[model samples]
Target: MSLSYENYLALEKYIESFEDKRGSLIIILHKAQEIFGYIPEEVQEFIGECIDLPKEKISEIVNFYSFFSTEPKGKYEIMVCLGVKCKKKGGYAILKDLEQELQIKDGEVTKDGTFRLKSVNCLGACGSAPVVVIGSTLITEADTEKIKKILHEFEK
Candidate 1:
């Protein structure tokens, strides 16, 4: 679906806020995600027209980056870091536990829309390998027990 009128206008307002600034496109893109939750094809096209950047370039940024999502997300985003370090340290087991606990598979949001779980490339916490980040919180040492604890906290 396309963006609502207020959402489109909010993006336009973000564009105006950065009219005189350099690197406005990136800022606009960020605001778009914040306003719309996820940047879909149509929203990227609208952003392109607003900033004079091509649709391909917009898509490239969103697609290449792990932080951005092309689809909608639940209120709480559960990102399991699957980088080499995280993997070797038992990240998969943690992910498996999470999937079973939440009753959702990879790249799927929970039925109640309370959580969305997805694998991420890296979260730059190699020192604390096997990471699971929930929203803004970085959880180090992602194990089945720890993951269970984490899920319990969110259930409240």
Candidate 2:
């Protein structure tokens, strides 16, 4: 499938709003990701065409940031923190439990495509160690049971 008509319109308008800006590449990438859910290769090509930049350059920007997802993510992307603080607070245990429950390796989406699990360096919420962010919601003080409950929320 292709991007919907409304998404195309939004892309055009967003591009125009930042046509001549000096340091707005990161912002542009965010807007693109919001419009397309994830920054697929084809959307990167369209962004390059709209801004008159090379596709590889757009690819570089996407690769430069960990926040941007290159492929299509599931309905829920669980971001578990693996920073120093988190590791000290059993983050690895939480991650291992999630891996087994979801039956998929880290960074891989489940078979039903309802959830995708990924690990990040830090969410800057060290005080709330062992944190996991589901979509835009952050869950701190997490453990195996907490993670299992959170994952159930994404279930039908």
Candidate 3:
């Protein structure tokens, strides 16, 4: 989606607020994401012009960080923990089930934009291996049936 002109103005003002601050590029990028939902190439270029940094450098930073997204995200971002413990506990199976249900693979959003599925390395909740995170709510000891029920709640 194209960002509104007003949103671009907001981002410019935000960047100007941190012009003199050291180590503020990442911070600015975060704010830009908040304003634009995702940092597309155009946003990256705009940020580059605002900060006088090359777009390549900004792109590298965005790419290095998994938190920054270049594409629009669904309202519910479903992250399936693929840490060693979770993986052993059937994490891949859970991911596959979500893909089948949502009809989208990892890092993809469903057609209706309700959900996005992603497989992350760890969520730091090994005690509850096989965890699934939807927004801020964590579903521990997650199984397909349980997840299906939770997804249904969002569908309604």
Q: Which predicted model would earn the best TM-score?
A: 3
Residue 150 accuracy (lDDT) in model 2 = 69
Candidate closest to the true structure, highest lDDT? 3
The residue-by-residue lDDT of candidate 1 on 26-53, one tens digit each, is 6777778888888999999988887778
Instruction: Select the stronger candidate by TM-score from 1 and 2.
Output: 1
lDDT of 3 at 5: 99
Candidates ranked by lDDT, best first? 3, 1, 2
Model 1 regions more than 4 Å off: 17-23, 64-67, 79-94, 111-113, 120-146
lDDT of all predictions? 0.84, 0.84, 0.91
Q: Candidate 1: minimum summed lDDT over ten consecutive residues — where? A: 19-28
Worst 10-residue lDDT window, candidate 3? 14-23
RMSD (CA, angstroms), candidate 2? 4.4
Native-referenced Cα lDDT, model 2: 0.84
Q: Model 2 over residues 51-85: C-alpha lDDT tens digits? A: 77888998988988998978767789898899999
Clashing pairs in 2: none
**lDDT comparison, 1 vs 3, better candidate:** 3
Model 3 residue runs over 4 Å out of place are: 1-6, 9-27, 64-67
